[model samples]
Target: MSTTLANQQRSKIISLLSPAYLWLTVAIFLPLSAMLYFSFLSDVPFGQTEWHLTTENYQAFFQTTTYAKLLWKSIKLGLIVTGFAVLVGFPCAYVLAKVIQGRAREALFLLVILPFWSNSLVRIFSWAIVLRGNGVLEIGLNAILPFEVDVNLMFSTPAIVIGLVHSYLPYVILTSYLALQAIDDNLIDAARSMGAGKHTILWRIILPLSLPGLLAGAVLIFVPVVGSFMEPRILGGRVGTYFGTVIEDQFVAVFNWPLGAALSFILLAVVLVILALSSPILRRAQT
Candidate 1:
């Protein structure tokens, strides 16, 4: 009777999970499988798929120096932005989690999230206005340093970095704050009672404990920044191309869907490799 009951419970569990399994298969797995399958086909002359399997797309990606350079640039940009975000966000998160209280803390949290409510494109355009020649930033700079020529800031690599950091800053702040808040106050107090200096406590106790949040924020910011198209497209202008823009052009402009799909997979592979390399650090941070 117990064996029969166990079987029934197992069957019920399977039944309960069946809908979610089906959804994953249909929504995620199927599309990914289709993309993989289609990526091997050659684009037919005159805008048709020949449907013959070929490795040319993958080969071409490697053979092209520009693509490699762009990939490197994307990686560099993502890392730099992640560093800046962490540097700016960590202290703010610490303050929010440890110092502030009541409505003020809630209000600050709300303000951090408020930017996300607006359209990203609108925000980018606002930056464009401020950075353009004779715009607000230029005017302010000119007033401060009249001898120095006012320089245009829009459509530069720095502009793209600033835009990406702005877009993703809230994620880092929230994650870090949650991690900081989760720590036991008694542990910190104990360290203080032991005569640990402020810097020593921060470095030895707080930073080590909060590292998981730092890694989570890094991963969250890094992946999107590398794959971002809009910021680089709108802000980068003709200065340079990122990998995302290349993949986008392959599909939309060049009409090479297979190549685009292949490039997308390559980007995915790169991100996986990065995560794999960082896994040890992430695990240690969590512990």
Candidate 2:
């Protein structure tokens, strides 16, 4: 009787979870497995083409310094973009969560995330027009100032960073707003009644509870930015050749599928390591 009951419970659990597990297998695990399998091959598997297992694809990354340098450049870009997003989005989130209320907060929230509804490619191209020499930004600055200004941000690293910040800023704002809003008003009031100053309250009570969300948003921003190529290509031009662009070249222009797969696997490993390192702190904060 006990065994039968246990078996029935197991079957019920599997029935509930089967659909999601099946979707994960079909959508994610299979593709990743295929990529890993292909990464070990010497050549692409096509009709009449000879292919064999080899580790040269990964070795290319180690033998040459270029890949490492480009990867470092990408990581640096992620950090810079994440920093800018946090700095610019935090105050907006605070206002939305604490300062504003009622219908005004809802409207402001909608306005803050309005850019997310637009096509990302369109937005990047629009920035290109605005950042070009003698463009809107240049014209505006020159019009206001006595001295003529040349704003040639186009085809530069800063341009890429700006586009990325514009694209991902809302993630931080949304995450931080959720975190800040979850705090109890009475806790803040008690802090105030206990003679805690504004800075002290913010530093001690607010920042601690909200840190988890900030980290979550930062992780979200950093991970995709590390893998980004399109925005950098469109905005950074000559300076856009980072790790992701190199991987893109391997798959698109170079047609080295195995090498690209290997590079992608390496990047996945790096991202996993970053998340693993941060998970402890995030877990502690949540607790």
TM-score for each candidate, following the candidate numbering? 0.89, 0.91
Give stretches of model 2 more than 4 Å off.
1-17, 281-287
The TM-score between candidate 2 and the true structure equals 0.91
For residues 2-92, what per-residue lDDT tens digits would candidate 1 score against the true structure? 9999999999999999999999999999999988876888763444534688999889888879888988888999999999999999999
Estimate, for each residue in 150-175, the C-alpha lDDT of model 2 and write its tens digit: 89999999999999999999999999
Give the TM-score (vs. native) of candidate 1: 0.89
Instruction: Write down the RMSD of all candidates, one decimal each.
Output: 2.7, 2.4
Candidate 1 deviant stretches above 4 angstroms? 1-22, 44-49, 140-151
List pairs with backbone clashes in candidate 1: none
